[model samples]
Target: MAISTVEATGARVAVVTGGSGGIGSRTAVRLAEDGLAVVVGYTANRDAADAVVTEITANGGAAVAVRVDVADEQAVAAVFDTAEDRFGGVDVVVHAAARMRLSPLADLDLAVLDDMHRTNIRGTFVVARQAARRLRDGGAVITFSSSVVGLAFPEYGAYSASKGAVEALTLILARELRGRNITVNAVAPGPTATELFLQGKDAGTIARLADQPPLRRLGTPADVAEVVAFLAGPGHWINGQVVRANGGIV
Candidate 1:
């Protein structure tokens, strides 16, 4: 599948928030591959966002880069409005926007927890709310969770808490949309080999983390993207579930 094939129809549009970064970037491209016009939303890093747009365009896929902070209602509304105006209406929403703050519960700073909550919990709600409003009746909404929510790692308390909220939101949102044919779900990924995962780790630390997965390897952006594509495209029946793309890592 190529972007050109997607541009041919031009009615299906997908919104991928935080698309300038790891999993979000790959998921945007993969959706384009599956024939959906893509809206790449970013908070910062216009260059990265533009690069994704350029790549899609160069490949003959229709895409645009939109800057919006998903945490703000007005900003998220603007993103949906742009998608409606540019590509007809939203058919898929991949809510990949998130903030990561790692600290043990004993040492966790309240400010850090608050900031993460603002982005992960509030941001997801804002986007999901807009998605609930603007998405076509049969459209799908994909939110991001984390494998740490299962592992209960020591230093991941703040991040895990935010994702826990997301899990709850996904479940209720799917129920709220019942009988509407709209599917809502979350994707929880293990330690993937992205810039975000590399930020605070040495190579040995990264390798040790990778070794923990049953597959004995870290995940790739494409690994998670494939799962997103499935939920957005063929996995419509998988509603209100947190599909883990963690390569068997708990």
Candidate 2:
């Protein structure tokens, strides 16, 4: 069955990649609350993505779940197509889908590096290209990066490198958009309490990393979502910049 959160009422639309994941799920809900119709893009776990859509609908917000492979240009394009076909047009894009494999540069498996680049780096570019071409005037494009890019933490090289490319793309794309009135920016988050981050680490390690932030606590998905909401809505002047959403971790 096709589910929709709220009736489309000519509201702005947002396509959020990785909408089944931690921060991405929260971001989809937040944008819906902000009066934008949302298309939640997920690679796997249709049930998880459906749950997010269900929550948004239950809250009287507008949302739909779509399957997308971030690395697949056609799939990503179809996500945007669904948004436009279901709603009106896309005004905001949050490319938060990514793959994180922690390893030092030396011992990292070559296949692992290939997978990371295909999804993280190449996927970001593919999505960004589509957003740049299709986003309406006064739209916003937000990409995800990690605070580890600045922390230079061990075992984060491959992931950080992919995000670094995202940061660079954010800047140049903003300039390239020139008179389009679109804002392109990257959000670099610090250590957040997401399942992706908590999976393999011991409790002690997680606690230690959380305490590194001056706030002395890990960031919640909601915390990051707020920043995304800002960039997508009122943060119009913040183009071509990376807003570090980490709580003083870097």
Candidate 3:
């Protein structure tokens, strides 16, 4: 496929934060498959990160793994630095590193809320700010949200609140970068079959959720990655939108 308007300035480099495994890892590979040099940023599990890099390299795609703490501006800055030094300027930034703890608001622990926001809200700001200042003339910044924000399910009050903040930041940043030709958007996935989501979930609960979507299946990491790849490569016009890649759950 020919490069879209988002690559007007030759946006061929991508950074995927929290990319050691799960959705982030898949996204890194997907972007690389689109011919972008990928920087896989992971906070821990270097082995997992190395594995991702290996897969991409084995596929003849350029990739490197960088350790990053989404909440640490300096660390995140380093991820961007590595991208420039190793590949070139960043053309796409996918912030997929986040924490989620489920609990009823009535029994929600304040400490848990603090922890989640520190990574979800503050971390998003640190990374998105860098993307805003450093992304090429025409590029994209994709953030992760959850369909629970719309579902209003039990035990998701704090989690959804944090994602709500993500949505707000995503929209405002898109407008803030109005003339830069950069697209800022968020992908809110629902009932994805990821280790993070499956932990502690009973089979009955999982089955119920899988059946809720019109498609009657849990979303795969590849499912959401495809959406991110579109935004990074060809779907340049879908700006400031919170795409519900939730299999019609909403």
* Top model number, TM-score: 2
lDDT of each: 0.89, 0.90, 0.89
Listed per candidate, the RMSD to the true structure in angstroms reads: 2.9, 1.2, 4.7
Question: What TM-score would each prediction reach against the true structure?
Answer: 0.95, 0.97, 0.94
In every candidate, how many clashes are there?
Answer: 0, 0, 0
* Model 3: worst 10 consecutive residues (lDDT sum): 1-10
Error of 2 at 31 (Å): 0.6
Q: In model 2, which runs have C-alpha deviations exceeding 4 angstroms?
A: none
Cα lDDT tens digits, model 2, 86-187, are 898899999999889998788999999999889999999999989988899999999999898899999999989999999998899999999988989999
Candidate 1 ranges with C-alpha deviation above 4 Å: 1-10
lDDT of 3 at 15: 89
What's model 1's TM-score? 0.95
Give the per-residue lDDT of model 1 (tens digit) for 94-173. 99988897788999899989998999999999999999888998889999999999999889988998999999999999
Clashing pairs in 1: none
User: What lDDT does model 2 reach?
Assistant: 0.90
